[model samples]
Target chain A: MRVVKTGIAGTLESSDVMITVSENTSTGINIELHSIVEKQFGKQIRKVIKEKMEELDISDATVSVNDKGALDCTICARLEAATYRAAGIKHVRWEEK
Target chain B: MEKLRRTMLYVPGNNAGMVKDAHIYRSDSVMFDLEDSVSLSEKDSARLLIFNALKTLDYEGIETVVRINGLDTPFGVDDIKAMVRAQPDIIRIPKADSADDIKAVEVLIEKEEKLAGLKVGTIKLMAAIEGPLGVLNAYSIATASKRMIGLAIGAEDYVTNMKTKRSPGGVEILFARSQIVTAARAAGIYALDTVYSDVNNEEGFLEEVRLIKQLGFDGKSVISPRQIAPVHKIYTPSQKDIDFALRVIEVIKEANEKGSGVISLDGKMVDKPIVDRAERVIAMAKASGIQFDEEDDK
Candidate 1:
């Protein structure tokens, strides 16, 4: 899906991730992740972000993640929420996901 | 056996820390709130958070409940879609005024349960009678759906709806509380008292706990972890009570073995109601960590 505006979800609280999804005039998905356990878990965190975005069918968006040791589920949750908001969708179509 | 719900701790759905470690406090149940405590703006996020937590976390022994927003709001239906899919032990309906309120939620719960491929009635319901109408129809709401396991009073709203405020002894909400307890008893469901919000005032909290306990309530809802221990302490059967219950069970068993219709203990007849109370006391004793031989109780 094409993101028209900036969509933000989650928080930088402990065990949470604050994510922002915005329009990417450029092609494809771009993610910038800043996490405490970056050195050790950076690859897994990026993989989760990409995977959830793909699940939402969001192929073109600039995603920014500020994670404070969030788990994989939290990352997926934040990513999905942010992507939905960015798509300008008010009611979630849960069946699709 | 009636499940022991001495305390059901309320954990805000949006708080990542509390939601993650709520089961550790050891309350009989933990209710993650997706309504009132959560702001409208963050409703979506909180729902997602709780759904994910319930999906992944294994809260072994403690029962898990989620309080979804009312059908009156925009977020309520969506809340149901996620929570029913997550499959917590129970789904709590807030500010239910009539049987229809619960029926409305049940419709969504069943649909989602079907979609999730879980049994139709696997998820249970608990209604919080928060207004005059809800209190007046407490019996109907308690018996609304077969899935209802308990009815709880939401004193803050009930008091407000009655054009009064909560007092130390809870006199303003007495009628509402009585209706809830009576309805629950009549319907054969659990009567759960509202939360005692004053976490610091031990004496006041203790007084309220005792009042509800004496009023035939099965248990009280607690807010903090510190509150759990005190509620358990009050509900714990005393040594004397435990012994009497044990003797009552032993006598009944001996009578059964001899094929005698009449059962007596200490020259007094043991009636059905007395036996039931004895069994309940034993259940409470065992739940409170009192050890006894199972065969002896039998």
Candidate 2:
């Protein structure tokens, strides 16, 4: 899998990610994503990130995401995660700080 | 056979006015749709509205269910988490194709239940069988989760995926409908026929409902309130039918008291299964507030 770092610069407190996916005739990608934020707003934050990802129009790819107190910039990481999954790279892990 | 529901009106989660007036329509079950009815931009807001509505409103004997987004989508997981927290009587999952899909949902349901501090398995689920693959795997999907109380066909999505046209009386969906009902019955769960989309075609609508009931579906998923009265009318047991059912139950009970496993009623054999059907009829009568004879109990 190849990793491309495409970033969005904005004052938005959340992250934005844009990606394109291509896969071969072999194995498919399995992508899983999760986000952990302040418990007070964890549910709301998760809802927002998920809504964005669902809005993304992509097929033939599996995307997994994990969130840890991520702002709008986290969208880049999500795209990266999706890219990695699409490319069949399994070693890279996303962690929450 | 169960009471028929000709109209299964769908209300979007974000529509407050529709939600408020839903009960007055008196459909069999109000499906608070959060899947296609919701746009990605408004999922969060929609969830909040549905949550608040389920929490505060009284539907007066109306069954409540929420149709979550497909598991393949990001919104799907979040939809389940939020609605599960609110605890609707049932969570309807869309685009399910296999037992694995049901199991995958069960895992997430368990986690969400823990987060919400609710007992595991407290909430029930229904699967909407939409594609050919889903139809093929109907039996496995029905049995995949003990939480699954029923199975429903999704005609709009299924027809689109199969690239077929919707014919009058839903001839295109007839085969899938048959397979689903057979599967649901084999698994001992309710089989719900898909929505009749042509709201203005009442004659076509009732005809379809009759065909579905004849096919042994427990009920139907409706799309409009106007269709509900007809569906209920068709499914409700007639007085003559109810009277016969009661007699069958009485003979079965007497035989059981005498340690006989079966009995004859009006020259036909009767057993526990026959009595069970009678009980359902009685229960339906009670739920629908229909009057029945007190002597039938004996």
Interface RMSD of each: 1.6, 13.1
Whole-model lDDT values for every prediction: 0.89, 0.70
- Model 2: residues with Cα > 4 Å off, grouped in runs: A1-97, B1-8, B251-280
Report how large a share of the reference interface contacts model 1 reproduces. 0.53
* Model 1 residue B185 lDDT score: 95
Error of 2 at B26 (Å): 2.6
DockQ per model, Cα = 0.61, 0.02
Displacement of the residue B54 alpha carbon in candidate 1, Å: 1.2
Which structure among the candidates has the greatest lDDT?
Answer: 1
**lDDT of each residue in A1-97, candidate 1, tens digit only:** 6688999999878998999999997988898989999999999999988888787888899999999988887787778788878988876776543
| Candidate 1, DockQ score (0 to 1) | 0.61
